[model samples]
Each structure stands twice: as structure tokens, then as C-alpha cells.
Target: MPPPALTRLSVDELVGMAGVNPWELHDRLMVGRPEQIDELANSFHRAASRVAEGDGVFGEARSCFQGAYSAQSGGDTINASPEVTKTANDFQLGASQLDTISRSLDEVAHALTTAQKTTGEYVGSLNAALSQLDAMAEAIGPGSGANEQQYNQIRAEGAGVVGSAGDLVTGVVTSYQSTLQDHMALAQANRWHSGSARRGGDPAATIPGNGTDPATVKQWWEGLSATDKQRLIDEHPDRIGNLNGVPIADRSAANELSVDRDIHRVDDVAAAHHVPSDEVLAHPELYGLDASAVTRYRNANHVLDARKTDANGGRNRTYVMAYDPLAFGGKGRAAVTIGDPDQADNIAVVVPGTGNHVNKGWSGAKDSISLYEQANKADPDHKTAVVSWMGYDAPDSPTDPRMLTPATARASGAALADDVNSLWATHDGSPQHVTVIGHSYGSTTVADAAAANQMHATDVALIGCPGTDLAHNAGDFHLDGGHVYVGDASTDPVGMLSSSPLGMPGISVAGVDGPGLGDADPAGVNYGAQRFKAEASDASPGSFVTFADHSQYYKPGSESLYNLSTIAAGHGDSLGDQGMLAVHRPSVAPVSVPNPLGGILGPDRINLPNPLDTGIGKLADPELLRGGVTDNHNH
Candidate 1:
């Protein structure tokens, strides 16, 4: 038989699209499109390096110019060379702009590399989960009968894995959209340099709600054009969001943009380090941070990034009402909401005690999320939200002398009051219940906030408090006695520290002359505030989990957590006397003359014992707060 004759293409077929050269097309198809992307990234990388080098050159020249000018010893004109100085200043500004562009390009390139790797990992996980599902199906033997219960259980678990993979994809899309929005905001800010954004005067002019009503700020904001509003966000997000009169929705939105912008800003400021290929081409999650880059990166942006995710991989919406990472010389202040408060039926704003701020924002979020989730469970039909308000520069460590006094609380209380009111300002129609919950020194903050202005809160809860500064009883808080709740663990120490006369300088000095801890212990039956039972099941890091220690307040499944959530959810049961606590009241200090040691060794130093373990000073906490009589020893 003759070799199979090859079918010859007709001239008409050859003229058609199929007649294109197969070999050349295959080569181009395989490599062309992807190469375009790679080339763009590589080119950007090269440009960034060259621009960075140019900045260093300009910086050196500026330094030399400064030195040469300084060395000249003559009159004004000779000593300061205006022409030279201007040239150097111009160079510095040019270098800065170049550096910014270079950094932005690097970020774009890293994002591309990271996306590719993530896709690969996700595809692998999807395949694995699918394989497990198949295995479980096969295990049932199809036609043969098996233990129905066991088969269902296996199938359920497999299905969960598949669902989780789907959730992962959804999360990726959400994160990308969020990141894109952040980048857009930053871009707008980069282009905005006009001085017109401050038409409302300085944000600090009236201190949000101190003297001016938030409604006024809202009115002023509403009158402005959309362009002006955008200008404010681009130029003064920190001011606009933290301002009391601003609408809640606008503030939350502005602050959200600011949070992401701050994170990227941190990256720009700390971009001096070289992100070598090892990290540049690594995980997008790392954002091209090397070992050294990682440290700088975290130091600069961890506080902002930490708020993005929850304990689980799931994303929870956190509103950044106010955030200043470098406030008070880098001590930091931030207020993060667990869910939307304006929309929630019940809202609780939690003030963390001393030794906590932006750095511990995530840990604070974990606690607030617990309260948030629990509140949801308690009131399944209504929305309940929590805000981890570390908006104050809390007294640093317990060892610091400042923590013992309410100086920080006194300084920060008015802001807290304004913030609480701001929540209501943004709410339309009638009103929603507002609860201000303070933990440890934070209780003092809450009390001070209320006493300074009308807090508008329906309830005030103090957990593990030292003392309320001045209000002798719950009646002094302006809120009804039944609405004030105090939760003091049986083992908590500083809990009662503020309740004693010694906790306050006025009390310890001359029969309550200075800021003493407890004007009157709210936990005492005489104080007339609801005292909920608090038993330690999970103490702090260094202490044992005995009923005699601290730190079980927000522990999962703990009784205190249950009661706290109950009140936060506006639960009727929380008001019932289920955990009504009764404890021995500590004796008041005898009025005495002032002494130096009295300042350091509070009344408790004189052997107050368990009796001093009073719950948070609920009503007069602000009075005690004004006294700066706070003991966040275990907060």
C-alpha cells in the first residue's frame, strides 16, 4: 500500500485565517502576553532604584550646601546665601517627589508577584478539598449501604473545607477592593496641596464637643460642597474624622481611608531599606519586606495593619473613628469600632485601661469582638456593636506615677464625652441606647467623660475599677442608679484600690482633699449601683487563674463576659439580680496632714487587705477620675 497521501489544503482554505503560520503563532502565544507584564514591572523596579540613587545625591549636595553656607562668617546676606538655600530646598522637594513615585511603583510590582503566588496556593487547596470530598463519597461505597451517620459526618466536614476555600476566594476579592480604594485615597491626597481644606478653621479650635455641639459641626459640614468635603478628607482626614460635629457616616468613611493611607505612608517613610529579590518576589502578604524591612515595616505600620483581620481569617468591619499613631511623641491613640454603631440597636464603647494604646489595638479588638459577637447572640434580632476606644494616651505602665492619678483621664475625658455624643449625632430619627464601658483606669475615663458633659448614655458599666473619683454614690453619675453596673472579680486587687480614700490624693491627704481612688466603692451595697458577680477563671499572663487574681473579665465563656455581653445587648435579664454581689466595704482613711510618702504609698500600702478590693468606682468614677486615682495594675 502506498504511504497515506497527505491531504492538501485548497487555495481557498490557505487564504483563510487557518493559513497563518502555526509555529510562529505558537511561540508568540506562549510567551507574549505575560512577558509584557514582567517587562513593565522590571522596568519600574529599575526606575525606582535609579531615582532612589538620585535622592541620595541630592541629599549629599544639600548637606554640603548647608555646611558651606554655615562656614561663612558675615552679615545677614553673606551668612545665609538665599540663592544657594533656595536651590537646595528645591532639590530636596524634587527628591521627595521622586522617592514617592519610586515607592509607589515598587508596591505595584510586589502586588503583581504576590497575586500570582496566591492564585497557585489557592488552586492547590481547592483541589485538595475536592479530593477529600471525593474520597468521602467513595468511602460510602455508592450502591452499598454504610453507617449513615458516619457518612454524613465525613461529608459535612469535607463540604466545610470546600466552603472555606470559596470563602478564601471571596476574602481575596474583598481585600483587593479595599486595597484599591485605599490606593485611590492616597493618590488624591498626593495631589492635594491647596490650603483651602481648612475652611472650617482648625479642627482643634473647639476640641470637638468640649464647648461646641457636634450638631453644629454636622450643620457646617452639610453646608459645604462635595469638593470641599473631599478636600477636607484629602488634606485633614485626622481632623475631619475626629471632629465632633462631623456626621458619623462621613467620619467613619474618612477615617477608614485614613487608616489605609497611614499604613502606606508608613511604608513610604520607611522605604529607605532595599527589598532584595528574596522578599520582593516572595509572598504579596509580606509586601516585599526583608528581615530588616520586616522590623521597620512592623514598627511603622503594624498598628494599622493589625486592625484589618479578626482572630479568625474572616474579616470584620472596624471603623477608625480617630487614629494618631504619632500623638504624644509616638505613644499613639486610636478608637476602633467592631461593627457599625450608628446602625446598631445597642452600642457599647469600651475604654481600655493603662498600658494599652494603638500597639495593643488588636488585643483590644479581640475583647471587643467577644462582646460584639456575644451581644449579637444575646439579641439575635437587633444589632449590637462595640468600639475599642483607646482614644486617650492612657497612663503607660502601672509602675508609672502618672497611672496612679487621673491626670490623663482628666485630660482625655472630654474627648471621650464628645466621641460618645458623636455616635448619637450621626444617628437619624429617634435615639439608640449608648453604653460607655470602662475597664480599670478606663472606668475613671468613663466617669470623667460623663461628669464633664451629658454623656447621653443609657447605661454605664465599670469593670475591675479602682475607684470613682468624687461621686460618693451612683446618683452622682447623672444616670439612674439602676443603669450603673460594676463588675469586680473576687480576686481583683486594684479593683478596690481606688475605692479606698488612699487611692486619691485629696482623700488620703486631708479626708478626701485630693484625687483619691474611691469616693465611695460602687460594689458596696450602700453605693446603690448594680454589682454583678465577677469570678476569675482565666487570670492575667503572670498571675494564677484563681478567684483572688485579675484578668478574667473578658475571658471566653467566663461569667463576667456573659454579664458584660448581657448589658451590652440591652438584655432585660442583665438587670435582674442573678449575680448580685455583696462584699465588705473598706474603711475610709482618717484625714491627715500631707506627707511626701503619702504620694507614692497609697492608702492600700498601709495594709488595706481584701477589703480594699472594691469593684470599679461606678458613679463618682469621674470624681475619682479627676483625682487621677486610678490603679490599672492588672488591666
Candidate 2:
């Protein structure tokens, strides 16, 4: 009775415990293999035996037996038989064994439950580790070309195992935090150490007064040569202050081409007044123009300059003239007059040739102007206006043609023609007849202008022409309806040269016809009807027949110049000299017709034919052969 020991508990007491299960739990515990079952049964039996020994109830029962024995028989005699005693003892032992089995089963079940939970937690942690590894691997995988399929498989498996518990979440967070810290450390090291080293030395670290701004220091450091900076940093790391904060000099701006300033100065007053700087510089006559003309031109220049100086300066009108050498200017500005602006009259444009310029004296402008002035003077009854157009960039010499080709000459001529037409339009004037008198290379310039449709001159007179493209007839150049007069002197050396191979080859003259320089009279020695003689009076009487050079065509009093003026003034009938009569005839009159020479005559057998027998017919006829066709003739 000192304390009821646990061993004093009866079987009923043991069975009454809340956690104990007698059958199902005990069965599980005893259901193992015989060895394990036996060991468990033995342990249970031992525990029961101890309990029975200490139990107050069982001891009391034993004491009762002892007392009964003493009461019923004096110390030696037993109340019951041995068999019954053995049976009761056996039953008690069996009950004790069963209780032990039941207790063991309960303990086993609890242990299994705890172990399963612990294992699940451990598995979950392992899975989370794998999952974090997979996530980190994916984030740090190859950037451009990665094996996506393998990554996805790893992610899916890891996610499945990690989803089971919270411990895995903690592990993943810890791993990510460690990885982030490591990456940040690496990045900082790269930026601070590696980048600073690349700059040769850290100015902030070495120099006392160096600014803390890394960018500023870096820019200065970069300005140094790699080898030099490295040498300084390595040789004197402590003395780096000597090189710190060096400033760079700014570069100066370079000179550039500008269009806003004038490029030339004019010394001659006459040139400054009358001629543009470009022309004056190009020619020699600008220095020597007449004082009177220069005065008039200066007045005009002042008016122009004043107008241009005004607010509405751009509205001022001006004219640009470009003349070539053969464009007969003998002294200065050519005196050209246009009369009766309202009347429809004859208009003549005189085109000179090579070696023309402004500063060469008045001869450059005067000669061409005189031709026109003379034409107008010769025909006072008729309204006539003459234009001494120096509308070409003429060659400076015979060899200058090599520089001034037909194509270049044409552009200048076309521009001049356009200006001329504009002037005519502005003045309310229409030339009833227009004639172009082209001399020397000016003939070629005129042909090009006409070909480009830049000139509407009714007649084209080519004097001292080297030759045009022989392949082209007068019609091909748009001068078919108009008179195309070719004047060349027998004395002219250019007249002797072959004028075939006409079109511009890359550099050479090709397909030019020989000189058909005589008068365009089939009755005459030169049977080419379009070729006309350079008049003897206008030229030197013996010059055309003797020298055969090009200059005689423009001699004063020469019939060639006379015929040119006469035709230019719309008076073709006035040209009655031998050369003129050879070409002149009424358009309506019938002339002798010649049949084609049928035989293939040898060069020696070919004889001179009559002018009427040749291809001479009325100018009205569209189909008449004025000259040889371009394929067989020189242009």
C-alpha cells in the first residue's frame, strides 16, 4: 500500500489504457517472421512477469492463498490439487504474453508513422536541392543555342519531388541567396579591378588630387598610349600623381571651300563695266575696248548694280553673252542695232569661230559686229536687226579645236540661242527671216545648235567650216527647208583637207567629206551645189585661189561676206555675183534636169557637169539633192 506500482495493475487495468489496442495492433506486431515474433513475445512475457511480481493485487492474491493454506491445514497440508494450480498459472502467463504482443504492435505502428514522415521530409529536401540545381542551371545555361528539351525534363522532375514539403522551399531560397551573393561579388570584382586595370592605373587610388569620378579619370587615361601608360604605371606606381588629370588640346577647324566670296578682281575699267569676269579673264580684248562703248557699258553696269543692290534685287534683268574667237570682233563691243521692234523683219546672227575672247582688242567684238552693222546699213529700206553673237567658247587656236569639241561647243551655242530668242520675245519682235553666218569652227557650233533645235535661224551659212558629219544631209540637221550655204576658199588649207569621217570618234575625226569649198554651182568646177566660193572682193582677190587658208573668208569687201549679208537681209536676189548667181534661181522656175550617171566611172573619167545638169533644182522641191547625201558626203 506504499504506492500502487505499475506492476500492481491487473489485466483489466492494462486493457483499460487509452492508447493500447489488444487485438489489431498486437497482431501487427506479432505478424512478423517467427524469430522476430518470438523475440517480441519473450520481451512481453518478461515485462509481464516483472509486473506480476510487483503488483499489489496479484501479491495480495498469493498472500490470500498462503493465509488460506495456514488456516485450512497446519503449515504442511495444501487446500487445492497441483493440477489446478498449474492451469491457473499457465493462463496468467498466456495473458501476460498477449499483452506484451499488443504493446509491441502499438509501439511499432507509431515508429513506422514517424519514420515515414521523416523520410518524406528528407526526400522533399533532396528533391528541392535538385530543383534548385535545375533552376540555376537553366538560368546560367548556354545563351545562344541551348538544349531546351533536356532542361525542361530536369525542371519537370524536380518540381514534382519538391512539391511535397516546406523544407525544400527553405533550401531553394538559401541556395538562390548564396548564388546571388557570389555573382554580385564577381561582377563587382570585374568592374572595379579588371576595368580599372584596363585603364593602366587607377588615378583615384594613386593620385592625391585625382577626382573620384571613375569616368573622368578613365577618359584621361584612355588618351595615353597603351605602352606609355603601362610603363608609367609599372615603373612608378607610387608616383602616378605626376600623370594625373592631364588635359587634351582641342583641334582647330580646317579650311573649306566656300561659294559666298568673289574669286577675281578686275583691273581694267572697260572690262569691269562691259564684260563679265569669266569672259574678261578668258579673252584679251577686255583691256582695250573703246572708251565710248566702255562708258555706255559702265552706265549700264551701274544701273544693273543699283538694281541688284535693292531689296528686290533678284527681279533685275541681265544678259549673258559668250563669244568665240572667229566671231568677228575686231576692236571692242560690237555695235549691233535692232530697228523697228514692232515690225516683222529680217534678223541675222553672225557666229565667229575659234580664238575669240574679250581682252584681245576691239577686233574680237568689232569684226563680227561690223559684218552685222554693214548688212543692216546695206539694206535701209528693209527692217533688219543683226546680232553679232559671240555665243560659243571658241578655241584659242587651230589646235584648240582638240579641246573645244562639237559637243561642248553645242551647249554654249544652245544657251546663247535661247537667250537670243528670249530677247526677241520680250521685245515683241518676230524675225520674218533669220540667217546664221557661221565662220570656221563656228560653223560646227552652229550646226550643233541647229541640231539641238536651239536655233530657229531661217538660213545657215557655213564659211571656212572644217566639215560637219558627212553622213548627215542638210535635212538631218533640221535645215532642209532652209538654205545651207557652204563657203570655202580654194586658198584655204582647211579646204584641201578631207572632210569625211564626220562623226566624233573617241578622239579622232571620222567619216568627214573632203572640202567642197568652191561655189555651189554644178556648172562650176566644184559641183557640190551647196558649196559656195569665198568671194574675191570680200576676200583678197588672189587669196582664195592662192593660199586656200581659212582666214580669207572674212576679209572686208569680200563677196563671201557680201553674199552673207545679202542673204541675211532677206534679199537672196541681191547676191548676183558669180558665186551668188551660181546658187540663185527662182523657186518656181524650171531648170535643166540631169539624169543620174549610170556607169561606174573611174576617177580620171569623171568630168565636170553643167550646173543645170547637176542636182540643181528649185529650192521648193523637197526631194532635190542639194548636196551629196550624208553617207557619201561630208557634213
Per-model CA lDDT versus the true structure? 0.55, 0.40
Give the per-residue lDDT digits (tens) of candidate 1, residues 203-245.
3221222223456556556655687687777777777776666
Task: List the lowest-lDDT window of 10 residues for candidate 1.
Answer: 1-10
Model 1 has an lDDT value of 0.55
What TM-scores do the predictions have?
Answer: 0.55, 0.36
Off by over 4 Å in 2: 1-344, 361-364, 401-404, 427-431, 479-481, 498-529, 537-549, 573-579, 582-635
